[model samples]
Target: MTTTVRWHSIPELVRDAAERFGDAEAVVDGDTRLTFAELADQVRRTAGAFASAGVGPGDRVALWAPNSAEWMVAAFGLLTAGGVLVPVNTRFRDEEAHDIVVRSGAKALLVQNGFLDREFTGPPGVPVIDLKSDGRHGFLGSGDPLERKVGEDDLADIIFTSGTTGRPKGVMTTHGQTLRLYEEWCDLAQLRAGDRYLIVNPFFHIFGYKAGLVASLIRGATVLPLAVFDVDRVLELVEKERVTVLPGPPTLYHSLLEAGGGRDLSSLRVAVTGSADIPVELVRRITTELPFRHLMTGYGLTEAGTVTASRPGDPYEAVATTVGRPCEGFELRVADDGEVLVRGYGVMRGYLDDPAATAAAIDPDGWLHTGDLGELDAEGRLRIVGRKKDMFIVGGFNAYPAEIEGFLMRHPAVAQAAVIGVPDARLGQVGKAFVVPRAEVSEAELIAWAKERMAGFKVPCHVEFRTELPLNATGKVMKDRLS
Candidate 1:
């Protein structure tokens, strides 16, 4: 049945879910489990406290925490109270968090005391509320009347992209946009009341915030939240909780496979991996090693939301090859130059207050110019080639590093690979590969493998073997550092 609540407002959905599935398990963390009724009540109380603290509509309330029940409650509370939510990356250093808070103009900040040996400090000048305070849980004991007047156009969140090249810009998403995107995802993934989901992705990320928390709540499903990525812990939770849906990036899945070893994972039914492409060999290993029947992949950006995802029933090749088709209400196109573009309700209003960058990103025709290059097949599936900005010219021919990396990953000995363009006096710029081998593969062997598969220019001119590749918080390889 289709939900009728206004897409822009979240409290309405919370009210409905609580009424419909009050007794169903809503959130689970270790020994902590909160039913829909309990979760909704807590959200109401949290919203009330925030309101009492002078937080109002359009005001930004920053949440700097890991994946936990409190994070979910704070997020919902802020939205229910008509306050904009700004989720800070848990991996952000002190200076980064300070800059984000100042840039977003958040008046209130909710943060965990510490996690994984990292301490989080609230943005200076903003009132800091401790999520772990014993008294913090008591704030949900009483009701505070909510002043819910948020409109479809009202800003709901400001998600900061990892600033690899420069300062991170906050992508402004509206309530209507996020709600609509979740609705589409639920329909596409066939999420229902009985579904049990395992959330390992950080809540600070749009992928986890939208797909894991918001989608589960709206669909009447159960969410199992984890504070950090622990493969063994994840396996235990999946089996114990009977988790039906598993959504994470390729690295998470790879780790899970490694940790599984000989463990039984029969309870897991669908494994959804994305955020970045997965190696074909890894896909094969998951199918052969795990009890999961359906392995899917999804594609999205912080600005456009999750627009493409392979369904559970898709073929193995489709799951490994493409990032599926456009999600409901979203349209995908390949520009003449091969850049991917999307137009949908999920697209952000624009980068917060940065008109020049916004203009460069979203064209006047309403299409969001995804900087990623890709190709659309006859079946409409999108195969991401690489980032547009990451492309480099080699002897007058455009060289996409992701293509080279994808090919290299097929080699049996290559564990991970990243390609970057380095200055060459002869070819203007030649590709250099930084590789991490699984065991002890030599650079000469890998180069021969690439030469056998790719063109001479596409193959690496020089190779460097390292124990590990540098990555950002999101697990994406940092090519800039390699150069």
Candidate 2:
């Protein structure tokens, strides 16, 4: 398997790809298109630009932007120059972005200032390079690439977690880990050469950067980066570009499935989705309704990259019920308390610059204590029950929102559902379901529906109907805002 081939560092991989897939279509964004060789040239020039701007090896640089062809170039260039990448979420406000830039000790900032109608001025005193400006390519150097020795083990990026809890902590990873893991991910997802991949996931996130762009690079797939998810735009792109590989959260597929009926999506053969809970019905619809030959779901986090995934030929039930067997050499086990533990090469080095928190998360035995509660079937497949912190007690009975939410989704009226524990006088805490209904449905009707389907303690005591639920950039429901 080519998965065994090691490039040592991302720069090496960039150079190797240029040689191996030189004339193949690499990246396409609207009017802009580049071959693999051209993409490599841009990466080298960008690296030289960074070197000229006083970014040295090991220096941290903040990348704040949406998904674009330029975003991929800038990221590859940053890695080529041996600068550690710090990708800020595009949804972050000025204050939120400023906090990450300052905390990560980013020496420079590459940003698209006018994106989403917000001006990202970047932090004071830091050099800000506007990636969207006409002068952006002027930063590219005319000379040969900068001579920098970036080792595989060197820190490649510091990706911050979604700050649903108190504050986001930086998850540090290396180029070696990134390259190795995603190779396996591509093999499992059936991503291959000549495939056009529509990357709608944000590049700042691991899935987009590693599983989207990096995997495309490895397999010689064409990259079509979509800045935002619009169902019509996505369908248009899939038909026009003949996009073959599309992986995203469940919401992206739901939107596509609803509107993609008359479109020419026969070119789309590979589809992978997983970030939040997925309904079995949706999985069934995707298989029966869509033209995809390969469809799967997997589980992972920023702390652990591509730990487990469903391989091609796996049943739809495995894709829906379990995250599949472990990939990328990860060893998985459930603790006595039900928390899932992962030990692998893909685990993050540690929380960047926070030893106390690192020590608390990873045990002395080299096992990462994933705070998610899960169970293993006899076949060794993992079914994520819920997050340990997200679980709530109801009248001394443990109730998982994911489990209840799954039950609620079985109802025909519920388009989307998110359950949160709300304060209750008698039960200490009870499930409060926030639902986005497909048809006319009352809160009392949903509560009654839940009552008949689940245990009395598991049933939601209250239900709130809404047109839509609050979603993060990745289409994950923001449970933090539910109350």
Candidate 3:
């Protein structure tokens, strides 16, 4: 007898890809290569291991590991075993990781004992699965494979927020909703069968996990997981593997430019970037220097995968300045207060076990109140102004840190910049800038230069330079950490 499966879950999709593209390369990690068929076999074996440990349907399993062949296996294994996957950020400290375990009530933690010179065992009582080693040889595989059915509405994953703002909230996502988003996401990204995708974004992030891996299987693309973001390593992989699709944040592009001298990067064809406004100069450089035939930018939040994406061959300035129009099955609207509201299949089920927070985020009508602020032009292009919380008032005039940061990026020497409001007795609040300079540039010079270009209220009154701005796993500036 067969279990009646209604929706094609992650496992089901992987199995389909294996059947359709059996001999095709599915994953490329270091010296290891896995075809779709082989990848499916490993997933089943890993699922058996989890099943042997009694991790069944609806059970919470925390995954605190980096990107690797084994990370992919464990994720599929847990989901295939009918367990809810909770991805924990590898950067999380012991206490931070412990807090998620307590909140999610994860019964099992699949953690790596050897990463960044740390060992995360978990908070006791919860069983732990250790997946640490150069290869999948150390992963679980001694038990018989388990076959289970996962419905569309079944819980797939619980991803905790980076906690840059207040406490980290767990966002719940389902298999059906996630796959639906990436079906359209794959189209926007122009991901296709046989294409090689280099995923430098951490697996813990929705961008890497769902948008990275899940999208790949949907289109039958080869997955190349980059455990960490190293410029040299990325360039080497791009050249060696002939990666066709490369998507990342603006900083990633900048880093590529820095490391991109005399490299045969002609293999790159489709380049997708977002998470922040990319500088016009940077976009020009990418278009001219890189061999990407289709370059695009998109906008979304943790609640959704990708709502808006620029079409292929969009004007360089347009692609650089604005995130493109909304994808199919999603609606975008700016609230009266300028907050961006998205309603669609991509919206998360809700915050994990946080009804109050979920209610506040997604209203009765289902419009997920994205805390971001944006404007849709007549042409339907979106320009993300800033986050609702990132907007600071100076002498009654509103100042958006993104706008200032965008302008700051124009400076040849500025590598990155973040602006935050500080208490000011006279003006109520003043803009404070945290900058990462590419070269030797003094804070006084930057402030003076900014003062000349921007209005008094918008110009950063305080400037500080650092080797790098505090960033979360997703390359977003941790503004809360700045102060």
Candidate 4:
């Protein structure tokens, strides 16, 4: 039986949350905590300031700050003022940032003065408002509300995906799309008003924005923000705030395991990880070492919101091996070429006016051709093998690099591994492996380890040992740059 889903705009969701949980602690960072009422007030004030600055509906306002309360306020403020928010990756270089701003045509930007020794210069011709100045808060202060009108179909944010090949394109998300995403996530994760969430992922990415910010706000949960990922500090926050929910990438889990060092993690009731595959070994380690029994791994793209997620009550294997079923209001299918196709409200509204890209990505029937390659099991769970563009043909055989990398990660000595296709005269294109070892392990050792488990062609033609692999802002290995 099918059921009709009710949709609300982003501002309406925020209004509902504030009205329902007005006095509840909505956000916490360091020593600062803002109640739901106060959070709404800040959003309105920031919106007023933006309106005064002449930002209105449909104008793109970019935010290039780390995980801070101001970032959240700026995002919501832009939405409240009917402005479109464009989130820039904090790890982007000046050139990358400049390219995004110019391509997106952002009228203004909001950024921190500096983060992690990196100072930001505002994009050319675009006014930049700093969030912090001389240790005093900047922007988001109390002000009068701005009279604005927005609908569910209005644009909310333009999140740029990590461009593995070339320049990043902005993925437009509508207010309705974001609201449906938050509600779907809340229902799938069984979120409750009593939950306290700790967010380590950057707010720029959809994973953190929807899962970390919108999910918590809509559910009347508290959000504890961290500007950076400090393994020790994260553990301390979990203990101090009694943080109930934890969300981040797989690297965070690995770091937490190393930093945990027998620290008490009983307060952590749920841990959600995404942005890359969660190694089964890491899943096992978390359950064995950490006090949290509910560990989950999910899948999402900037364009598709979060389509697939594993639930806490599912089997450990499901959470470890598969990306779970598609979230509610979404349909998933495997194309003839093995690409994952999605159709849902959560799918983005074309690539922000790039007709060529929009036509290439979404079909006429509204099916978004997710570049990731995967297959559905008999139980309807989706197992992501690798990116379609990353797949290479070896001697007329298909080789998925992610599968090979996953095999390499199984070795106890390997810290991280990236598999890429290097041009080979014999096979046209063959797989090559680059590894970062936990200890001193030679290429010969890794080659032998992989050969034993995988077919000869699937084995790395050559293994290169490196101190580290080149990772994008979100920490995913940049396979395209390796070769």
| Best-fitting candidate, scored by TM-score | 2
Top candidate, metric lDDT: 2
Each model's TM-score, in the order given?
Answer: 0.94, 0.97, 0.95, 0.94
lDDT-based ranking, best first? Answer: 2, 3, 1, 4
List residue ranges in candidate 4 displaced over 4 A.
1-7, 134-138
The sequence of per-residue lDDT tens digits that candidate 1 reaches over residues 291-398 is 777776779999988989887677878877888988877889999999899997778888887899899989999999988899888899988888887888889988
Q: lDDT of each structure?
A: 0.81, 0.87, 0.85, 0.81
Per-residue error (Å), model 2, residue 413: 1.6
Give candidate 4's total backbone clashes.
0
* Tens-digit per-residue lDDT, 114-207, candidate 4: 5978888776688878887611245565446753678878888888878777668889888877877777687677677978888888888887
- Higher-scoring candidate on TM-score, 3 or 4: 3
- Per-residue lDDT of candidate 2, residues 1-483 (tens digit): 225657888888888889999999999999989999998988888888888888889999999999988888888888889899999999999899999999999998888877889888788998887887832366643335764778879999999999987699999999989999988888899898999999998999999999999999999999999998899999999999999999998888878866887889999898888744777777777788899888878999999988888878777688878888888578999999999999988899999889999999999998999899999998898888888988999999999988888898888888788898988999999999898887788888888888888999999998988878898997888888889
- Scored by lDDT, model 4 comes in at 0.81
